[model samples]
Target: MTETTIPKRGVPLWVQIIIWVFIAALLVLVGITLNKRQQGTVQPGDKIPDFTLPLFSGYEYEGKSEVKLSDFQGKVVVLNFWASWCKPCEQEAAELEEAWQFYKPGGQVIFLGADYVDTEPEARAYLKKFGITFANGPDMGTKISQMFRIRGVPETYFIDQTGELYYVKVGPFVSVNEIKSIVDQKLK
Candidate 1:
């Protein structure tokens, strides 16, 4: 009888490479997520992050598409992040518009609507429905949202004239007075 040797089977080289590549990609993704989480959201007393917003059609300032946070210096800035599909946003839509109208003449307060992740037609329609006349615009690439670390739609930030965040409202303001109170305090 002759002695026989058996061959051992192992994972293919290409298969092992693919597995390693997959694991590496997954690790990279997790690292990015952790980094973002560590950055955290903007908070009261923090200096407002400077950002430029591209206003929607018919909402531009001085016929300019780009509006910078610094442009509204020496004025209180009400930066509201909202979406057309958000119910809580809808609830405060009219109130926000009213507040804008009230403060429009003074020019001491500037209201900027940052429509979050919304389509133009629908966002325009939502604005028309609510009669929003503020400097409403799309948060392009969600850069503003990321900079502010917004949790959801209808989050409003009150920035004082000095470019410091004074307050953060996580949800809809129940009344125009509620919105005004914050603005009044910041304007002081």
Candidate 2:
């Protein structure tokens, strides 16, 4: 008597699909990690991948009409992540203005601000009050905040001419005048 090999059929189709789905998800996440920003702690030596996003810099801030990180290539960029609700950010705005005015002309350095999560109306008002004339705008929840790994308001990252993250300010950046030295050294 010849015995035929019978296929085992105890597992349901749904179970197989679920297992496949989980595996697929895991693979996708691994791919994203390898392609996007790496998970390692970012330091001055790490180079940031080029990214483009719409910024709402004031209607008049030089280079504000429409700004992108790529546009500032080959220059020192002071990138400040701020919000309308942060008091420390409000305090730092004036100094940001001073620094922007001083550094913008002569084309030596560039200042850029990204509004972390705020309403458009409030953002517009902040623009007028803060005197932020450099590249300023809102991230609009389009994955920008996640890309930056923002834990709180007022995280500033300085990028050098080579598009490498030079410095990262954890809290509200105070004493804008003090930054002049830092900016001059890196921006020059």
In the order shown, the candidates' Cα RMSDs to the true structure are: 4.8, 4.7
Q: Highest TM-score: which candidate?
A: 1
Candidate 2 scores a C-alpha RMSD against the true structure in Å of: 4.7
Off by over 4 Å in 1: 1-40
Off by over 4 Å in 2: 1-41, 60-64
* lDDT per residue as tens, model 2, 29-94: 999988665553356667877665566734434544666677778888887788888887887788
lDDT of 2 at 85: 82
Best by lDDT: 1
Tens digit of per-residue lDDT, candidate 1, span 75-105: 9999999999999999999999999999999
- Please give the lDDT score for candidate 2: 0.75
Clashing pairs in 1: none
Residue 123, candidate 2: Cα error in Å is 1.2
Compared with the true structure, model 2 gives a TM-score of 0.75
